[model samples]
Target: MIWNENIECASRDSMSQLQTERLIRTVKRVYHDVPYYRKKMQEVGLVPEDIRTLDDLVKLPFTTKTDLRDNYPFGTFAVPMSEIVRIHASSGTTGRPTVVGYTRNDIAMWAENVTRSLCMAGVTKNDLVQVAYGYGLFTGGLGLHYGTENLGASVIPISGGNTQKQIQLLQDFGSTVICCTPSYVLHIAEVLEEMKIDASSLKLRVGIFGAEPWSENMRRDIEKKLKIKAIDIYGLSEVMGPGVSCECTHQAGMHINEDHFIPEIINPETLLPVEPGEVGELVFSTITKEGIPLLRYRTRDLTRLIYDKCECGRTLVRMEKCKGRSDDMLIIRGVNVFPSQIESVLLEMSETEPHYLIFVEREGNLDTVKVQVEVQEQFFSDEIKELQNLTKKIKYKLESTLGISVTVQLVEPKTIERSAGKAKRVIDNRKI
Candidate 1:
C-alpha cells in the first residue's frame, strides 16, 4: 500500500541526491529572502554557496522554538504575508505560540505528504476517515482533514472532544479510519466500554495516532481494545504538522519523507550527530516548504533511525517510536525519566488502566516523583492489604524501570481527567 512509489521507494543514493539539490535551493532562497536567516548564516561565517550537498547540513545554524518565538509572528517567514495562505500555531503553553505559515504550494505539499501517509496506512478512497484531532491554531485537525480529503477519502471534519458525538458518527457514518492523539483514542475506548458499546459493532479498521509519544505497550493496548491497526504518525506544527512521516502497514517504524523534509539524529547535549541507529534529539529541515522553510530545526523529540528497507518495500528512513522529548524529560534526583517509561511499565502490568499522571516535587534539595495511576475497575478494591500489595508491586516495578524511588498511588477507574489532544502526563511543581 505504498503511495507515490517513485519517491517513497526511491533508493537511498537517489534520495540523498534529491535532498542535496532541494537543500541547496532552499538555503539560497532563505538567505536572500529572510533577514534573520541571512544574519544567522553570517554569524556562522557561511553562505548558501557553502552548502553544496546534503552532507554539508551540519554547517548550518540550528533553529529552535526560542528562535521562532524571538522572531515571533512572521519573523522567520521567508515570504511576505501576502503570499502566506494559512497560519497555524502551537498552544504556546510555555510562552508565545510558535507560529507557522504556509504558501499555497506548502499546503499542497502538506496535503500530498498526508495523502501518502494515509495510503501507507492502507487507507484508500473507498474508506471513510474520521479526523478527530483539534483544529484552528493547533495543526492536528485541519492537517488530517486536508490529507484525508486529498486522498479522495470521505472525511468527517469532526474536531476534538464531543466523545458522544464522535461515537455516534462512528456508527452512523460507518467510518472505517480514525485519526487522533493516542491518548484520546484510549479515552474514546474507555467511553465505549462505559457505554457498553461493543467495538465489534464499529467499522474501524485502522487508527492513525500522533501528537504524543506512546509506547509499544500502549500501541498494543490500543490495538487490542479498539481492534484496529494502530499506525504512528509523526510531525510538529513547526515542521509542517502530522504528515511529515508515517508508519506503513509493517508498523516497524515511521518512514520519514526525506524528499520534502530531511531527518537527522543528534546528541542533545553535544549538539553533534549521533552514531547510526542511536537514540537522540530529532532534527528536521523542510527543503520544499515555501512560506516558512526551516534549516536544522531542533524538534526535541528523542528517537532513533532505521535505514533498512521496510517489509512493505519502502526505502525511506524510519524513526522508532519517540521515547520522549529532551525538554519534557524530568530530572528527578539527577536521573532522567520519561513518562513513556512509566507508561510502559503500567501497561505491561495489566492491572492498571492506561491513564496516569506523573508529579514531580522538590523536597528540600532532593526531588521526589509521584505516580498516580488508575487501577482497573476489576482490580480496584477496598481491602487495605490487597491494595497495599498492588501499590508495592507497581512501585517496585517503576523503581526498577525508572531507577528512582517513586510514590505510587492507585486511584479508582476514570479518576484522571481525559483530553482530546495531547495528554498532560507530567505535573512538575518544581517549575512553579
Candidate 2:
C-alpha cells in the first residue's frame, strides 16, 4: 500500500481533507469494533454519525494515559486476537502497563512511517544503520530496526549497552548511521576517548537520538564528539512508537506524520486548543490505525507546532522538540524546574559529566533541591581538597545559572548507575 504521498508536500487544504476522510472512517471503525470507544462515545452522547469532519473531533472526549491503563491488555483492542500480530507495552512505573496491539497491516504501516523518518534524516539504501536502542516491549529498537530494513539498508540491531562493543561495530561494520538516546551517545563518546578511538574513523555520519528531551546545545555537543550530525525522533508506544514524527535534514524541527496521525496542541487545564507557536500538551488522533485507534489522546508532552513549509521540501506540519512533560515538571520552593534545564547547565560546565541525579525533598516546610554530579574522569584527582573545590564551583555555577540555591554533591567517576535503556537522571524524594 502506498503511504500518503501528499503528506510531505501537499497544500494545507489537501492535508485537511485527507485527515477528515480518514477520521470519519476511523470513527466508524472504533464505534463498531472497540467496546471501550463505543462506551466513551456513548458517555459523550456522540455517535459515529455526529463526527462529520475533522473539526468535529474537538466535540469528542479525549483519551488519556489513564484510559489506556484502565483498558489494560485487550480492552482497547479493536481487532480479534487472531488478527493481532504483536503487542507492546509502556515502562509501567506508574501502574498497570498500557498495552498496544498491531495487526499485519499495522506492522507494515509502522515500517513505512519509519522509512519516511529515515528519508527525512538523509538515510539511503546504501547506508549501514546501527540501531542502539533497547529491544523488547520498548518501541525504539524495533521501530528503527524495521525502518532501516524498509529503507533497504543494512541493519545492525546492536540494541543499547556495551559501549565498547557498539564502538567496535561502528568500526568493523562501517556503520554510517546510529540511533540511540542523546545521553548514551555522549557516554559512548567518553568511552571512545578512553579507548583512544578517533570518532571520524568510525564512519558514522548520522545519529538519531530521542526517548527523552534534549537541547540544541546537547545536539551540538554530541555531533562534535561523535563527528556526526544528530537528528531527533519522537514517539510514544500509545501513539504507535518511535517513528510517529522525525527531524528532517533541514534540522528545523520534527515533521509530524500528519496524514496518518493528526496533531493538535491544547491547554492542559482547559482542554481548549492552543494557537500554533504556543507551547501546550499534544493530542494525537490515529487516522489509519487498525487494532487500537486513538482519538485525541492527551500526550502531556509540552511542545509548539510549526505550519510553514520546510526547507527539506516536506509540507508536513513540524513540531518543536519537547521542552518537558507536565507530569514530570518538578516544583521546588515555588520554582518550576525541569531536568532538561539542569542538564543544559551541566553540559556547559567543563568539570562535570552528563550523569547527575536531582534529589528533591521536603525539609520541614521548605523544599530542598540537590544536584548530585559525578566528577569527570580526567578532572578527578586523588586530593580531597580538589574534589571539594570542584563541588563548590559546580554549586556556584548552578546557582548563578538557575537563580536558585542547590547543593552540589560531587561523587567519584563512574559512580552513578548507567542505565541500559532509559537513563534515570532525576530522583524526586518529596513524595517519600
TM-score: which candidate is best?
A: 1
**What are the per-model C-alpha RMSD values against the true structure?**
12.0, 11.8
- Kindly list the per-residue Cα lDDT of model 1 for residues 278-371, writing each as its tens digit: 9999999999999899999998999999999999999999999887677765645323466777877888878545889998875532457999
Worst 10 residues of 2 by lDDT: 329-338
Clashing pairs in 1: none
Name the lDDT of candidate 1.
0.87
TM-scores of the models, in the order given = 0.78, 0.77
Full-model lDDT for every candidate: 0.87, 0.83
